[model samples]
Target chain A: MDREALFQQIKKKNSYLCIGLDTDLEKIPQHLRSTADPIFEFNKQIIDATHEYCVAYKPNIAFYEALGPKGWESLQKTMDYIPKGLFTIADAKRGDIGNTSALYARTFFEYFNFDSVTVAPYMGEDSVKPFLYKDKWVILLAHTSNPGSSDFQLIESVVTGRKLYEEVLLKSQRWATPDQLMYVVGATQAEKMESIRAQAPEHFFLVPGIGAQGGDLKMVSQYGMNAQCGLLVNSARAIIYASNGQDFAQRARQEAVNVRDEMARHLQDYYK
Target chain B: MDREALFQQIKKKNSYLCIGLDTDLEKIPQHLRSTADPIFEFNKQIIDATHEYCVAYKPNIAFYEALGPKGWESLQKTMDYIPKGLFTIADAKRGDIGNTSALYARTFFEYFNFDSVTVAPYMGEDSVKPFLYKDKWVILLAHTSNPGSSDFQLIESVVTGRKLYEEVLLKSQRWATPDQLMYVVGATQAEKMESIRAQAPEHFFLVPGIGAQGGDLKMVSQYGMNAQCGLLVNSARAIIYASNGQDFAQRARQEAVNVRDEMARHLQDYYK
Candidate 1:
């Protein structure tokens, strides 16, 4: 989906939350375990419960893949369960040689029909460019929240004097237009949000780590929001696995609603 | 596997070649099409015929992922078919947030039982550190051969004032010792092998783009070799689908033998 349509949805729902469906079989409610496919069953109910409160759903590929063949089936079913208007992300951090990456793009975009996929910039342009079609979004990894993030991503280059992640944000901008490219800047690193916004003010940032990861929502919105209200704050475990009892889906919706309500406050300040 | 064990296999077989099992269903031999599972049947034959000549088998995950559930079943069977002593790789370009990335590490290392997996370091150290464990390796993407690599990977960073890829190599070294980490430096970009070797020096490099991508094997060997002869040069289509007829496995063996002979010369130089 295009940016304008995505923007319209955010405005319509009064939220910028993207609920992450990092569903795992062992973690879901025991009541759903007896189903033929517990992962997909859990996901179907969660999507149904939380659809209205969030603008998007991100299904991390690893959780599904760990289940082997059955996991992939669950991923495909979950993608179909998500409604058309809401954005869907195949959170498969894929990047490879050009030809191989093209096939990956085909798998997520054509066969599975995801609106976007997260990409790793370490492979350079050819690996990421193949994923960018007419309206498909390529969310490049910029500054991450993990402690080890300081190891490589924060390194200062000897030639240009910019940190490595900053160069990734600056250089990757040349490959695709702002409409087609987005950056992944973790919500935990709220301090860097202002510098990131200044560098790529026109692009959207897919910010993960709000609820469970302890990233402050207000701080992220204050520094990262642009003229377009360009941010998608994702909260995975804090929502989907909110409860392990029969009321799991109901509890998930409550958690999603809580995040959405907080996001509404951010949107009000965002517009002002 | 440890570098000493890998080197022992290279010495015993007199080959440094790693055959890439990028098995695509449409590309399998026609006779195999009648088998219960064409993709798995094709992989089994290739592994049976070429197991003695090659020390490793690299399966590109996207090929298996595209077929959905059935394809994944084929991938597991293919992994099972390879001889126990031979090195195995899941060419899954995975990198994500720290906690989520830890799950991916478990998926491949525990569930899939791959000796190593490819990683994209754009998400920084946290995305990569979770993959390093006892006896398992995380091969990070370094310098790829694609046309768009110059856009971000080769750009000059203003902070460190060096090219972006160099910073990744230099900074990521601190996270893991050489044995636990490897880097993927494309064979097509052989000219830069000198610099890569200088920076990485001790780590093994998973070199793609050798056969089908038209990279010169001789030039790559010259500049990319390390003290331990640390390079896993892969050839995918040029070996696995060497012939589309019924004699595909036999042809695949012949192609692998040819690369093995060439690799012998490179290893010989290392011993010298």
Candidate 2:
């Protein structure tokens, strides 16, 4: 989907929430384990329960990959099951050399048909450029939510005096427009969101670290929202694992509703 | 595999030549494309022909991933076909948050049973730590082979006056010992190999960009060799695509032999 279509979805739903499908076989309800494809089954119910409340679904590829070839099947099934109009982000942080990266672009965009794929900026321009297809998106990693984000992303550059992530934010913009490019700025770092938003005002930011990761929805919305509701605040564990019982999907819907309702209020108050 | 075991294999073969199985269905001989599981068939023949000459086989994961679930099957079969006592590197330059990185670690080290997986150091220590299993390895990206490697990698840090790649080399050393850690010092950057070797004295460097990318094996061997002959120089296209006809396997073996002979001479001249 293009930038306007995504913004329309957020506006129509009155929500900018993106539910993350970081589904683990071991973490799903015990009864579902008896099913043939437990991961897909779990994701199907969760999507059915929460699809109305959210605008996008971001599947963390590692969860499916750990299961081997069978995992890829589950992932493909999950992708097929997600309803079309809503956005899809393969939260697969993939980047490599030029030719190898093109294969990855084909993997996520052509084979699996994701709207976007998260890419690491460490490999620089050519590694990231292949994924910048017309309507498809490349959500480059800027300020990550993980503790380790500080390790390298914060290092000051002697020439530009910009921190590593800032350099990533600046240099990457030259390669693609906001229409096909976004940034993965973790909600955990809400304090930096204002400046980051100021720097790249037009681009969307896929914000993770809400709910289970201790990121405040109010704070993130206050500092991060844009004219088009330029934020995809993701909550994975808090929504999907709301309850491990038979009412798991129902409980997930309740959690998503709560987050979405809050997002609606933030949309009213913050979104220009 | 541990450092001593890898060194033993290198000494036994008198070579540290790593064959990259970047097998593409479109690029393989037309005859092989007609067969069932052609990727695996081609890889099987290549392994059969060249296993004795090379000490390590590095499979670029994107080639398999682009083909979807079937591609994964071909990779598994190819892994099963490679002979015992040779090191395997999953050139799947992957890294993410701690929990996610753990899943990727399981995918490669446990599920795929690779000796090591190339990791991008963009995510910091925790993202890399989970892959440091006993007898397993993490070949971290220090300076890459591509032209874009100059973009962020060579950015000088204000505090330490060290480059970004230099910071990666220094800071990452604190996370793991030389036993399980290695660096990817690209062959295209042979001029920097001597300084890199000095900074990372004991750790092995997985050198790519040898043949098709125009890196000099002799220069790389001269500057990058260590006490344990710390280098696994990789040549993919130059060796694997030596012929496109039915003689592909035979010709591939000849190319492997030529590279291995050159590596043996380097070992004889440079071994401490």
* Full-model lDDT for every candidate: 0.84, 0.90
Off by over 4 Å in 1: A157-161, A188-191, A212-215, B155-163, B188-191, B212-215
Tens digits of lDDT, candidate 1, B129-155: 899889999988877776766656776
**Residue-wise C-alpha lDDT for candidate 1, range A1-272, written one tens digit per residue:** 99999889999998888999988878999988999998989999999999999999999888888888888888888888899899988888787757688888988999889989888877677777888898899988888776767756776765667777888899888888889998889866556889899999999999887663233888898999888889898988999989999999999999988888888888898797
- Model 2 stretches with alpha carbons more than 4 Å out: A188-190, A212-215, B212-215
DockQ of 1: 0.58
Per the 3 Å backbone cut-off, how many clashing residue pairs does candidate 1 have? Answer: 17
- lDDT (tens digit, per residue) of candidate 2 on A40-104: 99999999999999999999999988988899999999999999898999998897968899999
Interface RMSD of each: 2.5, 0.8
Clashes of each: 17, 0
Candidate 1 falls in which docking quality class? medium
Query: What is the model-wide C-alpha lDDT for candidate 1?
Result: 0.84
